[model samples]
Structure formats: C-alpha cells, structure tokens
Target: MAPLIVNEIISPDTNLLIAFLIGIGFGFVLEGSGFSSSRKLAGMFYGYDTTVLKVFFTAAITAMVGMLFFSLFGWIDLDFVYINPTYITSAIVGGVVMGVGFIMGGFCPGTAFCAISIGKLDALAFIGGLTLGIVFFTEGYPLFEEMYKANYLGTPTMNELLDIPRGVFALGLILMAFAMFWVGEWAEKKFPREEY
Candidate 1:
C-alpha cells in the first residue's frame, strides 16, 4: 500500500474503521486493567497501586520502540506523520498544568471517558468541567495567544537535540522504563492496599 495510508492508498472509510477498532481495543484494555476506577487511578499517586504506572510506561516504551523499528524497516513514512510545533516554555507550563489537573481530577481525559462509560458520576462532573475549560480557553484565546506563541522552538526529535543516535535514545528510554517499573513495584509493596 505504498508504505503508508498518508499516501492516500486506503479509503477514508477504511481508515476510520481502523481507528474505531483501535479505539475500542484501547478502551477495552484500559477498562479491563482497572483504569476505569477513580480510586485505582488515584492509587498511583498515593503509592498504593502502581498498575497505572506499569501499564502506561510499558505502552509508551512499546510504541516508541515499535515506531523506531517501523521506521528502520521502511514500514511507514515518518515524514507524513504530523508533529506538533514545540514552544519550549509554553510546552513545559502546559505539561505541568496537565499533571496538576490529572492529580486533582484522578482521571485523565481518556480514563475519564472510560469511567463515564462505566457510570461514574465523578467522571461526569469531570467531563463537564473539561468542556467548560475548553470553552473558556477558546473564548479567551486572544488573551493568552502571545504567551502561547512565545517560545518558537521547531519540532526536533531527541536525537536531533542531544546529537545522539536514535537507537541510543530508544535504548535509554527502555532502560528508564524498566527502572521506573522496579520503583513502581517497590512502591506497591510498600503501600499495599486491597483492590478497589
């Protein structure tokens, strides 16, 4: 199929179908992994349950390594993939705000939706707040637009910034994931709690 769907080889219907299937699988896995519970999700912050940490770290490493391998084997066209333009300071601030929100809400947007599917009232309230926040941000974009565009760093991969081989970065990431997994395990044992 000419390496990638970005080449317009796949029909729109097929592309969307593939996305729908993948989304369903992702949601199912999350729900099965106890991520649909606010208590369990919050447990990670409390060091009582580290399933969230392990699952997410594994997923990230897997995706990164898979992408690297795919690029190496000519399975996909990396150039056709969309990359977000990096605004260094704004990006750091945005990520901090996002982390704080996640800690407060006990559910990131994706898990909030998963919890809502399972009839969690807290998730419903979270969704309402998220919608309101989005509306406010859209309405007030002009006020923050300058700051949003302040740091105009072009999108560059780790290899580009660190001047290291892509494989080296990938290896370092995998090692870091493993180290964190070990810490997560220890945390779970140190603060063991019955399943929610």
Candidate 2:
C-alpha cells in the first residue's frame, strides 16, 4: 500500500488526508497513554518508571517482526522501503542535542505536540522554543551546512554492513528487546516511586 502512494495509485490529496487521519489517531493514542505528562516522561530518566522504554521496545520489535512476516507472505514488498541515510557526525550531534532536550523538557517533539493538544502550557512553551530553534537553523544554515553534510555513510543498515541475512538481525533485535524488558522491569521495582 505504501508503494501505491509512491506509484500515485493514491492521489496526493488522498495521501495527505490519510496522513492527517493517522496523525490524529497516533496523537490520541499517545495522550491516552499518559505520554502528554512531562513528569511521567521524565520519570523514566530517574528510573522510577519504565513505561516509555517498554512501550518503545515492544513497538520496535512488533514492527520488525510484522514487516518480516508481511514480506514473507508477499503482502508488502520490502524492496521499496526507504532507508535513512547515515551521517555519523550529524546523527551523533543531533542525538545528543535531542537527548538533553528530552531530559530537560521531558518531552520529545511528538509528545510535545500531544501535550499541546491537551492544553499543556509548558508544552506550548517548549513548542515555541522548538520553533525558534528551527528558525535559527534555517537562518544559519550556511554556517552548519558543512557539518550537516559531513560523514555521509549512504543508506546503510546493519544487515548490509554486517554481511548477515535480515532474519538474523531481526532475531537478534527480538532477543535484545526481551533482555531490555527484563532489565526495565527490574529497574521499575528497584526504583519504585509514588505516582506523579
């Protein structure tokens, strides 16, 4: 169905409408999960909660497994999937910045949007700061363009770089998620706190 969008089987307007609808559903789910609360989000860092980590790992594993099965059944063509280009330097820099922002603000961009919809004043401010940062990046693009484009590693995946079959990596990922879930559950017990 994704290729249908690229092949124009779905018109641009319909594609956009679909995206909007999906976004709404996603936002609703996030809000329902208590992700819109900054304190709950920040609790993960203090080890008082592990819902975020558990949910993230579960979702990742589910998607990986689902994709593998879908491809095996010929329900979806994996060949048409887009791979994100790996820019090592920029990725590290961006990740570090976002990590700090996540720790301090207790919300990533998506959660901030979800919070905003539920009338969070702090989330609104965070969104404003995020907007300003974007504007600054746009205005100062010339200064950062060189660093941004540096360390291009093409659209590489572990299966490609490691000389292994995709199934091997997917299996490893499932195992890793299980291990992480074990550790997360332990941490939640070890650092139990009254609910925020």
- Model 1 CA lDDT for position 164: 97
> Tens-digit lDDT track for model 1 on 6-106?
76778777887888999999999999999988888889999998889999988988988888888888877777767789898778878887788788889
Show where candidate 1 strays beyond 4 Å: 1-3
Q: Cα deviation in Å at residue 172, candidate 1?
A: 0.6
lDDT of 1 at 123: 93
Candidate 1 yields a Cα-based lDDT of 0.87
Distance (Å) between predicted and true CA of 43, model 1?
1.4
TM-scores, all candidates, are 0.93, 0.93
Model 1 Cα displacement at 125 (Å)? Answer: 0.4
